[model samples]
Structure formats: C-alpha cells, structure tokens
Target chain A: MNEVLTLKNVTKSFHQKTAVDDISFTIGKGEVVAILGPNGAGKTTTISMILGLFKPSAGEVRIFNHLPQEKQVREKIGTMLQEVSVMPGLKVQEILELIRSYYPHPLPMSELISLTGLTGEELKTRAEKLSGGQKRRLSFALALAGNPELIIFDEPTVGMDISSRSRFWQTVDSFAAQGKTIIFSTHYLQEADDVADRILLFKDGTIVADGTPAQIKSQIAKPSVSFIVDPETSLEKLYLHTEIDDIYRKNNRVYVQSSNTDRVLELIFQEKLAVRDIQIERGKLEEVYEELTRGTKEAV
Target chain B: MKIFQMQCKMEIVRVLRNRYFVFWSLVMPILFYYIFTNVVNTNPQDEAAWQAHYLMSMTVFSVMGSSMMTLGIRMVQERLQGWSTFMRITPLSDSVYFAAQMVGQSVIHLFSITIIFIAGALINNIALTAIEWVMSGLWILLGSLPFLAIGTLIGLMKKVETAAGVSNVLYMVLAVSGGLWMPLEIMPKVMQNVAQWLPSYHYGNGVWEIVRGGAPEWKNILLLVTYLVLFMVLSKYIRRKQEVA
Candidate 1:
C-alpha cells in the first residue's frame, strides 16, 4: 500500500532562515514514527508544513495521498499543534460538542472524554480554568474528536508529568493497535526510544539521521566497559595502552571505552582482576543522537 | 450551510460566555442610555418636537452602543484569542466564518437593542409609534454593517486585548461624534463634520429619525454601506498578507 503519509523533498523557510530544508520521508498506516531533535531542529516546523498551517517555501507534502490544502484531505487528518490556542471561554465538554458538530462522524464524546483522561469536574470547567496538563489533554482530545485516520502530535507531552506522559504513550499505542497512523514529534529521546518504530532526527534544518531505535544505536562512536577492580593495574598498560580510548573513574568504579575488545579481555583474565561486576555498555539512542549532531558527515 | 450553521452556533455560545459581553452588551448600553436620557428632559405635554428629539437620541444611542462596542470588542477578542485561527483554517472558508460571525453578532446585537428599547419605552418613558419602532429596528440593523466590518478588521489586525481597548475607545468616540448622546444641530461644526464621517452617526440618526416619524434618508445608508465595504475590503487585504506569507 502507498504510505499513509509522505513528504518528498520538502523545504520550508521563514523569512531568510531555512527552518526545514530538503527533508523527505514516509510513514505507513499503523506505524508510529517519531521526529526527534533538539530546539530549533525544525521538528515543529516540519509538522506545521505537513498540517498545512504554513506554506512550504519549497517542495510538497501529502497526507494519505492528498495535499492538505484540499478540504477533503483535511477531514482525513487530525492535528494537535505545538501551541494550544483553543478558546478560553469554552468548557472541555462544550469544546468537544463544538468540534463534534463540524465532522459528520466524530468519536463519541464520552469515549473521548475518557480516552483523554479528563475527569468529572474538569470536563465541565472552562478551558482557561484547566491546568497546563489538562489543557494539553484537552487539545489532544480535540485532535482525536473527529476520528480521523491519521493523528499528528507536535511535542504533545511536554511539561506533562511522567504518569501523564506514560498514559499518553499508551493512548497512542492503542490508537496504533487499531491500525491508525501516527506521527509524533518530541525532544524526549527516552519516549521516542520506547514508542517509535522509526526515529527521524533533524538538525540544521535537514534530516540527518533516520532509522529504527536499535539501528540508530549502532552508529555510536565506540563500545564501553565499566567495572570495580580491587587491584589497580592500569587497564591501558596491561592491555598495551593502545585499546583504551578514554577512561573515567568515580566512587571506585572505572569506566572505559575502546574499539578493540580482544586485548582488553586478555588483560582482564591475565591480571586476575578482582572484578566485582562487569558490564559492556551498549550505546543508547541518546548517544547516537549526540554523535549524529557532532558534525557527522550525514548532518552536512 | 452546515459549516455556516455550526460556526454561527459556536460563535453565539462563545460570545455568551465572554466576560466582555457581560460588561459591554448587558451592563454598558443600558447604563449609557439611562444616563443620557436622565441628562435631558423632553416635556411630554405640548413640545412633541422635544419629545421626538429625546426618543430619537435614546433609540440611536442604544444602536450605537450595541453595534460598535459590542461587535467590535467581540471580534477583536476572537481574533486575539486565536479563535479565528481555528475558524480561519477551517475548510468552510474564511468568508463563511465571517458570515457566521456577522449572523451571530447581529442576533446578539438585536437582542440587546430590543431589551434596551423596551427599557427606554417603559422605564425611561421614551415614546414611539409601532411603525417608528419597526423602522428604527431596520435602521439599527442597517447601521450595524460598518461596525461589523470595523470589528472584523480590528479583530483581524489587532491582538485580542489591544483590540478590546481600541474598540472601546473607538466606540465611545464614535458614539459621541455620531450624535447618539446630543443633538448634532447644536454641536460645534468640526464635531458635526467628524460625526458625519462615522457610520454610527448615520445609524443613530436614521434610527432616531425613524422613531420620531421622520424619513430615513439615503445618504447615511449609502455612507454606512460604503464604510462597511471599505472596512471589509481592508480586512480582506490584511488576511491576504497572511495568506501569501
């Protein structure tokens, strides 16, 4: 099947500053793709272009084989923008009703009220009276209200407590389970690591890295080792000092990194190092993100 | 039609919930009308001309307050609060959104005018013929168009808070200049000239004159229509700037 969402060579600029440059990718139906990047990394800008909130300076974006400029195409998509600008006078229930009137087949209000986790008193209160987290939840509720096939969240869980964020991911997972397509944008790498099928990282207004969580981890500079040793034989000296790339010690725990592992293991056995505990450190998505942003050839 | 109705209903409900509606629509118009009526006494017995003058001023004042202050403030607030963003981006088209707003605000403005007109007749003892009353209502509706455009533009141009304040000042200034409170015949020439330029003046005069058994002239109607179209065009231009960028 054609990907549920696609952008081919999309570039968007604000004034003279290029916010999103020549970026292209696609996400299939039922797949959760995370757009991961730091501040000003064009993640939000990229999503805005997809939503048709802003016209792209270059290139085209399509959601479900239709441009957002088409009204019929918009009905197939739901969006929670980075900024929540809902009317303050509207209560959560009232807001839901208002949105419900627009789309012919909206999600049941009660179902959505619960899916968003809004409680009794909160549901009746005006939007301005809502707490920040409640506001975010309500915004998401509006996005989901129309029961569109595709939902795009722009940094949805920011400032939310861990529990709320976790609940949010569960909600997303359930949506994905039902074969709904999702595109999530967030700076929280851990969240992306947990939920994303594919994580696309943008830096300098262009996408620099795109891969699955496990695949991205493989790009880390070097493997690491950490252990507590009783006898202080310099690992560098014992291993011919050539395999050691870097060493850090604190609280009587030693951490070391190197590309070579054979010499290090030989030294560990020969010295009979009284190792309390040993762990081979596999690089995390965070480490790979750092490496990608460190003037990697891919970023350029 | 579905989108239009939905938008209109939403605008009506949203306006009903606004704090500014409490102050502008409910509180301020009645207060201003009561105070202005108190300052002048139109003898009921023989000086029917003076009574006519009093009734006209009061009715026109009601229209002035409802259309300018009420509509302008609400539009500006909707613009600033990002309420327009939701409506603006909707597939129904921005013109549909504006149509809904106009319909919603017209209903609201009419409601306020009715209540205030009743209070004027019963409580303030302003006299009017049934024909005159119907004519006044018609003129009031016609007078509302320019302010509707002005409010729309202001809402589109200014952020919410600034729009509210700007609209309030503009309303009051136009209310006074439009001769809603006093007789333009007795006012200084410059102020009269300024009043002539304001659409509120035509609405106030047309409604007030119609209420006093005078003819509703076409000049004010023409001027009001001209100003309304001009403001609508100006707002459309401003929106075009957003569209291109």
Candidate 2:
C-alpha cells in the first residue's frame, strides 16, 4: 500500500492541556478514514496538525514522505475547515478563480461548479451576500478547485441542509472513486458508518478504538440482559462466568453485558437471585460508541 | 507571476466593492476638501498655494482612511473569521499574499490621489507645472508606506471591534495632530511642535514642498522611511508574540 499520510507518535499541547496525545496513524492512498470524537476530543487539533496549521508539540507528521508544511505537500492537499468563511466582498466565482490560481494545474471552473453544485446565480453573488448554505457550497468549491490528491474536511457538513449534505457526500463519493485519499472529522456516527472505510474513535486526546465500522461494532457491541433486582440481592455469583463482559446497575435494574446472555440469564436463576422484569438488548453501533467514549464503568 | 496578478486583481475588486471604503476614502475626503477650502475659509493670501497645500492634505486624509479603516479592519475581520487560517493551508505563500495587498493598496491610493488632484484643479484652478503634479502625487503615494504599516500592525489585533475602535481614534488623532485637517500655522504652539514629529505631517510636508517649486526635505524623506521601518518591525514583533501566545 502507498502511504499518503503518516503521523508518528504526534502530540499537541496548549498551555498545560494536551490536545492530541501520542497518536500515530498512517493512511494509504485511496483510503477514506473518519476521525470520530465528542466535543473537545482533539479531532480538530489533529486535523490542523495534518494540514500544518498548528505545529505538533512532539513527534512528526508527513505527507507523501515530506513535512506537512512543504510546498509539495501543500500543492497536493485541499481542505475545508469547520468554519464556513469566505472573502467578504468578492463574488463566489471570483473567490474560486483566486484560489485556483494558487495551484499549478487546477480543476476547470465548470468541473468545480458541477462538483460543488453551485448555481449560476450563486456564482455571481458576493460572498458577504451569500446565505449560510450558499457559503458552504462556495467553500466546497474552493476545496475542490485545487484538484488535490488528498482532501481533508473538518466537520464539512456542519451547517448544510439535508439536500446539501447529501450532495456534498455525493461529491466525496466521486472523488473517492477517483482514488483520492480523504480524511474527515464528524459528529454524525451514521455518516462515518456509511462513508468511511475505517474509523478512528478518539476519547480524551487518545484514540481508544481504531478499526473497520463492522469490527468496531462487533468488538464492543455485546448483547446484554437486564432485569430489576432487589436491593439486598447480591449478584456476586454472576461474576464467576467469563462469558459475561460487564455488569452495572442503573436505577433498580441490573444490566448483565455479555455475548452469551442465555448463560447470564441461567446463572441468575441458578443463583436464586430475586429478579424480575427481564429484558434483552441487541448490540448496536451507537451503544458501542457510547460505551467506549463515556468511559464510565459502574461495577456492581 | 500570474497568481500574484490574480490575487492583486481580486484585492482591488474586494476594496472597490466595499461601500465603507468608497464613502470614507474617496467621498468624505473630497467633501472635506471642498468644505474646508471654499465654504469655511473663502479668502487666503496666495490662494493657489493654499489650495495646492490643502489638496495634499485631503489626499493624505483619503489614503490614510483606506489604509487604517478599510485595510486594517478587513484584515482583522478576516483573521477573526478564520479566512487567514484557510489561506495558510493553501499553496499561496505569505510573501505573495503580503505583496499582493501592498500593490493593490498602492493602486487604490494612486486612484484617490488622481481624483482629488483633479477635483482641486477644477474647483480652484490650483495650477502647478505638470512635473509638480506628478512629483507631488508620487511623494504622496510612496510616503503612505508608514500608514500602511500601521494598518498591518492594527491587523494583529484579536477582535474586529477593538481594531476598528483603535484605528478610528488613531486616524482622527493623526489627521488632526499632523495638520491634515487644518494647517499647523493656524494651530497652537504645542500642536505645531507636535506636528513636527508625526509621520502624517511629514507625508504632507513632502508634497507641500513639491507644490511650492522645491524638492522634499531630506529630513521628511528620512523620517517617513524610518517610521515605515519602525511600524513594520513592530508589527512583525507583535505577530511573532501572537503566534507564541
């Protein structure tokens, strides 16, 4: 596999707080990877380091074997930051032309328009006069203007309407079809599940999970059985089974997390623990996300 | 080269489309010139020299307004809005961006100067040799370097409102104290003495000498250049400090 980006034990800190801690991930050509995290989880900081907007406090970042700040790397990478900002007075078309001029061989204006789905009237409108959705489209057009081999988007669909969001993903799909490597950070888990070939889940500035969407889901999303239990009923014997993954009490209900819920249920009866209102939960991606990221385990 | 030209062209378009710039830099200065020279003070000994001198004053007034209010404020707004961050990720080098802004602003300064000079010619028949017109215009154009530096320095500010407020106060104080709004001859002794030290006063002084059939004083030229270097160095220092912070 051809590596398009490489980060080796990269760390970024601001003041006394670390933003990204000892993260190292290499992305191959044509790979579509998503960085998933909750707020303040260092996704933006990691992306900024990759784009050379912020210097890493430790370790190294490279693009195509050159430093991220090198002219060669800059020429081959395009980005749209989380904030949808544009030059205030120039028309959309003019902004596009100006950005395209920075590249040696830019995409044709017509192709950019087609890719970003910008209308003729939108193109003529000044940037300050653009509606939020229109400004997002213009930002997308600017990102694609360079025809870069590697594209990074920081929360790219943040303020887009549903239709605009779908169109933006469609454009990404076509770009990926062209074998362009893409890295994006997003809050929407379903979008990552649908779009990304791999997911890097972050928590507290460290990647807690990295795998394919299915692998992550299966690894953490164990089926569980829950039932209301009496307060004095000690559930200690259930802990002897290795098939059970975890156990926690919420309200008067005790949830037994395990791949083998039948065994857990049998153990409850075998131990003669006073329990009632039994229910079972199937594994899900959202649950896995919540479990890994929340990082709170109430062992009882 | 093509990229630089394209960036410059866009900067021109951006400035021209700004109504604030058009109103303050072009319209307000011309209005002040007519009001000060004709409406307020009708008679002065050697009216042509007074007309020419006041013309340079308004020219300085116009260019300074653009440099401080338009250029500086817009830069602050862009940085605040993350447009500067976006540009940094591009292949566009910082040197190229800075050069484009300087050249674009110089072109704008030249435009306003020609308009005000033409307005002076029409209103008061403020006649001088063709070379006088060209030399004074050149001095005004080049002498604005310090004001442009101050504009960039103002851009290092964090907030748009703060930058706008500071530039507004600075613009008025510099214009009045440098004797651009009124002649130092009519002002108090303290102000006259203060004007001797201001870059704005020296900027107008160079053009004033050229219109009076003489070259700019070496002192004025050296002072303007020194201020330009000083402000630029200060801006660089602040920018570095900001990056560290």
Candidate 3:
C-alpha cells in the first residue's frame, strides 16, 4: 500500500486502564478507511496519538513518514475535530480568512464554502447562531480549507439529522473520489458500510475485524436461507417439503433459516411453493459488528 | 519572523478591540502625567519643581503601563480564551510568542506614554536636556522587563478570573510599594523597608533617577535585571507544567 500514515504496535494508557493496547494499523494514500467502534473503545485515543495531541506508551505514529509533532508533517494534514466550529462572534468569511493564513496553499473560500454545503448568505452569518447540522457542515469546511493531503474526522456524525447524515456520507464519497486519504471513525455502521474502502471494527483496545464489508460479511459464519409461504400451507407439509433448519411467521409471511441453501432451494423448486423476496443476508452492519466484537475480543 | 509578525499584528488587532484596555491605554498616562504630577507640586509656579514632579510621575506611569499590567493581565485573558493554544498549533516558537507579546505591548504603551511626556513638559513650561528627554522616553521600554516579568508570572500561574484578580491586587501592591502612586518617603517606615525589597520599586526607582538627570545608579538597575531573569525562568517553568496537565 502507498501509505500516508503508519502506526506500529501502538499502546496508550491513562494510569492503569490501557486506552489503546498493542494496536497496529496503517492508512494508505487515497483510502477511505472507516474506524468503527462503540464509545470509549480507543478510537479517539488512537486519533489523538496520530495528531500528536497525546503520546502513546508502546509504539509510534508516522505521518507522511515523519513523527506527527513535526511541523512539516502537521502542515500536510487537515484536522477537523469534533470540536471544530468556533464561536458565533466569528463571521464565516472572517473565520475562513483567518484559518486560511495558516497554510501554504489552501482551497479558495468560495470552493470550500461550496464543498461544505454552505452558500452565499449562510457564509455571511455568524457560526454560533447556526443549527447543529449547519455547524457540522462548516466544521468540515474549515477542515478542508487548508487543502491538506490527509483528513482525520472523529465521530463525524453523532447528532446529525437524517437528511444531513445522508449528505455527510455523500461528502465523504466525494472526498474519496478526489483521491484524498481519510481516517474517519463512527458508531454509525451504515455510514461506514457506504463509504469505507476498508473498515476496522474496534473492540476493547484492538481491532476485531479488518477488511472490506464483503470480507467481513463472509467472516460471519451463519449465512442462513429463509422462506415465506401462505398461511393455508400446513407447517407440517412445508417442513416435509424442504430441509429448513428453522421456521417462523409474521403477518402470514413464512420465514425459514437453512444451513444448506442449495438443498433448500432445490426443495422449494420441488414443492413449487410461492416464494416472495428472499433476502440472502441481513443488510445491517450493526448486527454483524456486534456478533464479531462480542466476547471474542479482549476489552482493555 | 513573518509568522511572528503575523501573530503580533493579529494579537494587537484583537487587543485594541477591547473597550476597557483601550480606555486605559489613553487614560492612565494623562492621569499620572498631568493631574497626579500637578497635584504633587507644592510649589506649582516654580518651573523647576513642576518639571521634577511631572517627569517623575509620568515615568512611573509609563513603566507600569508598558511592563506589568499590559503584558500580564492581557496574556492571562488570551490564555483563558484559548487563543494562546490556537496560536500554539502554528509553526511559531515559544520564544517567538513571548517576544512578539513584549514588542507589541511596548509598542501600544509607547503611544500613551509619549503623548503624556510631551504634553506634560509643554504644559508645565519646563525644559529637559535633549539626552535626558530621549532617555526618559526610552526608559519606559528599557524598564519594561521587571514588571513584564511580573505580568508573565501572573499569566502563567493564573486562569482567566484568578489571573485578573491576582493582577489587580498585585499591581496595587507594586504601585504602592514602588512609590508610583505615592512617594515612598511618605509611606510608613515598615512599607519603605518592604518597598526596597520589591522589584517594582527598583523598576520605578531606576527610571525616576535617570529622568531627574542624577548620576547613574547601578544597584536598583541591577536588581531590576535580576527580577527580569527570575520571572522569565519562572513563567517558562509554569507554562511548561501547564502544557503537561
């Protein structure tokens, strides 16, 4: 991988509770990697170490092939923290202009404003008076203002409106299309599934699952086949017709789970029963994530 | 250097916007140079006595304004607002941060003191030797350290409100102790002794001596320099600890 950032054997602790314990990961250039974890699962700690906000106990972080504290390294990275937005006292133009002076080649104010989903009149308004979703959009705008090669957004969407959340994912996808590296963390699983080129599900102080969503889905052991049938069809007759492992019904929709999908399909063909909309897998990442991380990964 | 200059300009712009500090910048020197000095001249019609009184009072005001309160309280305010941390993420060095603050504060204080000195001399109809006049104006800057050091110490040790409260109380103590607000000779014998023990008194004493065109006095001048070193080291130490916490 053409990596922009590398972490090796990283461990960080506050007193005795190991915040990050022997965790290692790398983010390649132009890769949109979603860091998925519950709250206090060492996601923020890892990000802080990468940003040089705090030092790690056991390992090191290499940003642009240099330590994060180095000015040369920091200059290449744009940080829009969870606390990115400033006070209402600052007009949008004034804040952008001030932040722009920090970098060598920043995105033009017009471009950044557009990228963040803000327009002419809203850009003139004070930041503090903006709605929560508006503030989040502006936060991302400021992060992109520097035109940095790498952006790290922690918990990018925690309290966003559904429409705004959808927009946020679209922005992430757009950033990826621009070929910039992003290390974004969120408990919002569906967002991860949508945009992440790769996903690392954090558990305790380490990653429990590391791969593309398909690879993780394949890692899930129980891929069951299900069937729905008419209520008039006898349960015993249905059981006799197919090798169904389990059967259940809700609103006259017959549901079945079978270990042998091929035999189940063959039995369905043989029975000539009505089958409506067979969902091959659960579309929810939350279910898969919980099953992967629970009891299997060490917590701290 | 460019970064320092940028930070300096930004800080100055922000500070100039504050109503209270802006009000003080214009008001304090005139209060000291004209009113307080004129009030002290028991023989106001005597041009020589008026010259002595005006020069001494204004020197006291200028040194205190430029060094102690401006650097200390203002820095504390900036730290409280998290502006200092905002500035810290930049490529600017710690030394640059401190140096720019010193230079900027002195620059603003320069205007207030300069106006007061020129107006005081002209109004009193008194003349000073060309070197003495120039030196007295320069003394406001030269004597900036001890009080600035004091201000920095306050900034390092305090958060917003605590720093403000501490600075006001300490400025009062220093003003009294240094004989800036009153004559040390008029202070109680105990206060006179305690006054001699403080760097503020030494700071004020150094400038007061030069403006009077007296022979160069080395002891108080040396003591003020000592205070400067002590304060810089102490404040640096405190700020370093604050970063860790």
Instruction: Put down candidate 1 lDDT per residue, B42-156, tens digits, no spaces.
Output: 3335454454555556555555555566566666655565555554444556567667877988877677667766766775566677787777777776677777777666666
Indicate whether candidate 1 or candidate 2 has the larger lDDT. 2
Higher-ranked by DockQ: 1 or 3: 1
Best of the two (2, 3) by TM-score = 2
The candidate that wins on DockQ is 2
Which digits, one per residue and each the tens of the lDDT, describe model 1 over residues A1-300? Answer: 658888989988777877888989888888889999877788888887887777788888887788876777666677777777677667888878777666767899888987889898888898888888888888888888888788888898888898998888899899989999889899888989899998998787888888888877775547777788765565555445767777778678887777666656666777777776877776667777776666533221
- Native contacts retained, all candidates in order: 0.35, 0.84, 0.04
Candidate 1 — which residues are off by over 4 angstroms?
A: A226-263, A267-279, A294-300, B38-82, B86-92, B124-127, B242-245
Ranking by lDDT: 2, 1, 3
CA displacement after TM-score superposition, residue A231 of candidate 3 (Å): 20
TM-score versus the correct structure, for each prediction: 0.88, 0.94, 0.78
lDDT of 2 by residue, B191-224 (tens): 9999899998998888888988999999899999
RMSD of each: 3.7, 3.0, 5.5
Q: What is the TM-score of chain A in candidate 1?
A: 0.84
**What is the DockQ score, from 0 to 1, of model 2?**
0.87
Steric clash pairs (candidate 1): B80-B160
Model number 3 iRMSD: 3.7
Give the candidate order by descending DockQ.
Answer: 2, 1, 3
Q: Could you tell me the lDDT of residue A234 within candidate 3?
A: 63
Error of 1 at B199 (Å): 2.0
